[model samples]
Target chain A: MNASVTARRLPIISLQDVRFSYEGGIEALKGVSLSVARGENVAVVGGNGSGKTTLAKHLNGLLKPSSGRVLVGGEDSSKTSVAMLARTVGYVFQNPDYQLFCTSVEEEVRFGPKNMGFGRDDESALAERALKLMDISHLREQSPVSLSLGDRRKIAIASVLATSPIVLILDEPTTGLDSVESAQLMATLDVLRSEGMTVVLITHDMRLVAQHMDRVVVMSEGSVALDAGVEEAFSDPDRLRRCKLLAPPITVLAQRLQAQGVLPKGAATPLQLVELVARVRGERQ
Target chain B: MMRAFELTKTKVRYPGSDFPALDDVSVGADEGEIVLLLGSNNAGKSTFCRLLNGLVPNSIPAQVGGKAEVLGRDVRRTSVARLATLVGMVFQEPDNQLFCMSVEEEVAFGPENLAIPRAEIIARVEWALEAVGLSGYNARSPSNLSGGEKQRLVIAAALSMRPRLLVLDEPAYALDPAGRLDLYALLRLLRERYGMTIIIAERDAEEMAELCDRVILLRNGRVVADGPPSEVLSDIDEVVAAGVSPPQIAHLSSLLADRFPGKTRPFLTTDDAEKEIADLVRTAGSGAP
Candidate 1:
């Protein structure tokens, strides 16, 4: 495909034949190999029990791959402790309750920086930066439990971002988020990407893959199925449906019309719908 | 046959709070009908749900003033155990209600609490799980289920009781998009197949507009707007001022209205919006103003 090799310039994470299993011998990930560069926004998509979350845990050294190797900035994931890896890889959980341990929003954001041995000034600065980035700076003194689910999610993201990790991995980033919250979150990730941070988002939302991610990695039955550009992967609806995923409505409409000889077949993404209409009109003319 | 009279005043105030959590709220839902409650965070939607099942004065000691009747019994005087047969209340987080190890046990807890027979409890459990599309997960542990499955399991638990009114308080908030769709499907089935009266307190105006026949909008603990979904959600500026997102299609429609002046007014759902758009295109093609 003549793909550029720019992603290999400064590889931050490298997984070689990575495989993982829970305590009960349920294999979650198998023979997975991928590399995440310093400033890449790679999205991992799959259905239930497809090992996306297991892969997320491996990035932060929380769960060691059972049979293979995972490298985080050249540090062996199996050998490094979670506390040590926390500085290099930040993991935001899907459920805010799991990550939110502090009472107040400010306390939650400050926990990571303080634990990482930052001084008072640096800790407060990181907390402020994280809170502002998540857009929950107004709720700094409010109790985390009392906040709405959306606001609590922001606090959870802020807590993770305070660690200032080189790589950010969020599992199911848009789960249960409304349109506004989802857009705000994607925008925040976009800002972080501009700031040169590596973002690895695990999601089932195809719209997110098409709109936000640079690269797409489709997982299935504990293995990587497709690792390609966002546009390339989502162009095939049959493949996506096989994984129990559906594209956005606009994209699906465009694809159906194209397949029925009503529009050009190249118009697969939603952004190309308008062009598809124009091309069809031109053909008629 | 369920009804309420002069239900004009029911209030619940937390200790040391000047204003009540629920203030002077009066709403009704007839049998075999779905009523949606729409509001922002801390808008007393949950409080109203708790009131339906007599959890206000009986369990939490709310200052219940006005009369609220459920299945012809005064809610203020009825015990929660007795009222359990009429109203089933599901909270936002399913994990809060699920304490049992297995799904079978979790769904059976309510019926058992009501002293139903063992055989009847088993039957009810099976029927409930089947209703929510969790038939095979009876032996599975509640903790082992996924987020979607767990929420369905919660719905199954509520359905096992066979309450006439199923009151869900933002049941889809913790679920993913697929999970939300599945929940809505189950709710539709409950309304159609079983003829259950569904009362859902939600912030998603689009879903409520599609699913419920009537939506009762609450603001600052008062019933501000109560009518059909089309009437309630069409007023976008008012809904926004009440601190809630209007329907997605409605929002887009309003934006379009600003651009295509005198073309189309906003609708709540995508189907209606599509029809409106098609009509607009036709009218514009016909040389309308």
Candidate 2:
């Protein structure tokens, strides 16, 4: 295996010893290194001010690293312009208001594809599909500014989706959404992931991380504190605590059960825990 | 018994909208109670909150109908500025409420608007910041603070008002796990120590199933279900229909109930689930051959 040949197979997104600092000399990302393979669903979670968002900004060239390199599709991020990178990566803002400025939702969704130089027919097709995916087709005629927060969030996501980027990064997409809306959004993302879209979700909601993401990356103090499979990450509460995070309640319950010898040591979700209990009762009888 | 606030048949319709934002909602809370409002998106949770502080019809201009009385004052009769001194509101976008240069100034803005004494305002600035765990952040720029820190600063601003009622709209939406836990602890402390009544709107009843006094479910701008956590949250069908997810413990208990016949209703909190599991595993261990 030649080193040159192996470098060609670099992850879809990679950060090489990246360090970033704000204008005031405050370091946000301190020598952090990370990578995401093609079509992988990864959750980047941490407390506020932990550099999760900073690390994400580096992926799409929104913020250049102060001391290191970032690679997108085996290309140097520093050499790439944001407009050029927009073809491959779509970054959604946490606050919908920051990105939404169009008078109508339909126009908002079409703005991205049009700006990307898509033809009139291609723009309409993309915008319509994106609107349907977010279940906001009816709201197309309404003003994006006057819509509810949840609807505005959907519009923001639809606008990003219209561009049809292969790699999508959502920052706290479900913070203000209710359970049903969040579930719908996650389900939509799941379908897109199945169609070979790389997803990077920045959120503090561990439940979504456990249910939707296959891998977890914990950030703490401007560094990657832990990166592991989802089950392994949630199983260790001590490691999570060191990073100022906590596993969801169901995971904690599963850990407690494993400690008491009620079952073998393993990670468990809500349904998994219920199944374990029923299996134990069956064996006891 | 004198109630802190009461709304009977409260109905509100925004300008040029077909459906009412809040439709015939009747709910009330006594003094020093922590009531939670749970619902899905566009489910009128925020509308209900705005009505409490007279922002719906007064400032926002909506067609409002209903009797809303807060702390013995009718919401319609009171001016929003006067109501500000009585009802402290923390909007969903808390950053909008913060316009001052520093955290201390932001908290002092509310009390100072009411012409509070200079010494009292100074004392309030210290007490409010300390209450929200921002003691040393007095001089920090509000814009430079993190999202979670900005949320706490707004809460401190609300605390400085010393209002009889507090209506927080998804106050923990931007907070991390530790920050969320801290916010809940602070709310509990307010109710326990200072006898403050808090009405908070939340997306789900996860950790709060064990903390709040009453859980009110809203669906399509109407009151769907209202009861204690164990009674309301355990009803998975209703909670899910109302667009809110029940606590994980509730889900575990519901499944356990289905597996084991004749078990009583589901449990809502992790503590209750822990006790049930300990008894369960102990039984399983004793029968090993």
TM-scores for every candidate against the unseen true structure: 0.81, 0.89
* lDDT per residue as tens, model 2, A11-40: 788899999999999999999988887777
* Recovered native contacts, candidate 1: 0.01
lDDT of 2 by residue, B1-289 (tens): 5698998998999989999999998989999888899888778999989888989788999987878888888888899998888888987766788899988899999899889899999999999888888998989999999777788889889889988788899888767887778778988887887788999998778898767999889999999988887788888888888888878888788877777655434566666787777677566646432
Runs of candidate 1 with Cα error greater than 4 angstroms are: A1-9, A43-48, A95-128, A131-156, A172-187, A202-221, A225-285, B1-7, B134-146, B206-208, B265-289
TM-score for chain A in each prediction:
0.89, 0.91
Lowest lDDT sum, 10 consecutive residues, model 2 chain A, at A1-10
Question: Which residue pairs overlap in candidate 2's backbone?
Answer: none
True contacts kept of each: 0.01, 0.71
Task: Kindly report the docking quality category of candidate 1.
Answer: incorrect
Worst ten-residue run, lDDT, model 1 chain B? B277-286
The regions of model 2 sitting more than 4 angstroms off are: A1-10, A97-164, A264-268, A280-285, B281-289
lDDT of 2 at B210: 64
What DockQ does each candidate score versus the true complex, computed on alpha carbons?
A: 0.18, 0.57
